[model samples]
Target: MSPYLKLLFYLSGISFAVSFEIDYSNPDVVEYDSNSQIEKTEKVDLRVYYCSFCGGCVYFHTKQLDPTLKKIGSYIDLKNYPYGLTTRYKKHGKIYFDCAHGPAECHGNKLHACAIDILKNTTQSEFYNSCMMNSTWGGEGSSDKDAINCGKLMRIDSKPIIECANSERGDAIMEYYGIETDKVTNPKNKHMPLILLNGKEFNRAKDLMKTICQTLTKPPPECKSYF
Candidate 1:
């Protein structure tokens, strides 16, 4: 078992059956407009709370994370919450969202939500997400087609994602993400990409692999270089 996983098992004193249910209306998520920024595991349980249109998120994924995937990816289990600094309110049996980046960003968030839920696999969805997000770095606007195109590139069926994105289900999913993020203390994550490792906020500006190694209760061989 991975050391991180062992730590998880030790701390919980139970099986590692973590749930991914989307939980509420609002969270203390930082929103990036031209805007903000923000990774994985099969071993380290990692969660990223981010928004689709955040430039910081895009740059982090495209520049920092993409190249690092091969080094430390095997030891991680990753998940993404695509709603950031977004709020929702229910009225007359319907939920409405107000996103910082406008309607297009809301749409982008829905696409990501649908992809993560519909694909049903964290790695696959992350790849799909990475592709779509990386596109924006090249000055691509109108993110829908690019995101969908990324899905297709992975040979993932985009139909379900598209359907979910345009429907109420997508909104509900976004709402749930908002709820999950709400559990995080507001104002703590003052910048884009609020990352949690082992359910605690991860604060660091070091190399990704090294940071994980340092955080582990028992460092693995792969982490030797950092030490």
Candidate 2:
């Protein structure tokens, strides 16, 4: 791996050790005698993968870092932070994605855990912070009304994809948001697909959130849950 990746892994290991609290339930009572064992696992994993593959990792990295940086913190505030975390990149500025792929290159892969973590850890301040950033990434309202607006925007942005959802319940929700399934082209006249879906139509923002939620459906709850 590259040096950057290595560094990230090292930092991840140290942070994980200091940050995460181990939970050894009855099933693993005999595995180790103390939390130190758990901390060891975290360090090794961070070294081996350079990543926890958890959204909480993103939570700490983004929220605890500098605000001017490109992390979720720069765009969001601590109050908007999801449930599992403690801060929102409060001290540092934006940093790059640190994943193999860089930021501004999102293809719905690296961001899943991060976003879900934030949603779960959200506070009123973070909510308002998100709203002002663009009101698109779980910011501002996020209620049914805001969801409708987001749905409308998503539909307008992904016409063909949204239409493919045609008879899906998700599509029905999108319609309720006042976003009709149709084609839209920017000034460049390029075709734009509205709505995003893993398999079916995404009628509401929450519908799309299902995909984000999938990233956290694992053990140790790598990415904390807000809902």
- The TM-score values for the models, in the order shown, are 0.73, 0.16
Q: How many Å off is the CA of 129 in candidate 2?
A: 12
What is the per-residue lDDT of model 2 for residues 175-213, given as tens digits with 9 covering 90 to 100? 222111122212442111122233232233232223333
**Model 1 residue 64 distance off true place after TM-score fit, in angstroms:** 3.4
| lDDT (Cα) of model 2 | 0.24
Give the per-residue lDDT of model 1 (tens digit) for 3-37.
33443343333533321111101111101111112
- Predicted structure 1, TM vs. truth: 0.73
In model 1, which regions exceed 4 Å deviation?
1-42, 136-142, 217-221
Count clashing residue pairs per candidate. 11, 37
Question: What are the RMSDs of all candidates, in order?
Answer: 14.5, 21.3
What is the Cα-based lDDT of residue 207 in candidate 2?
24
For this target, which candidate reaches the highest TM-score against the unseen true structure?
1
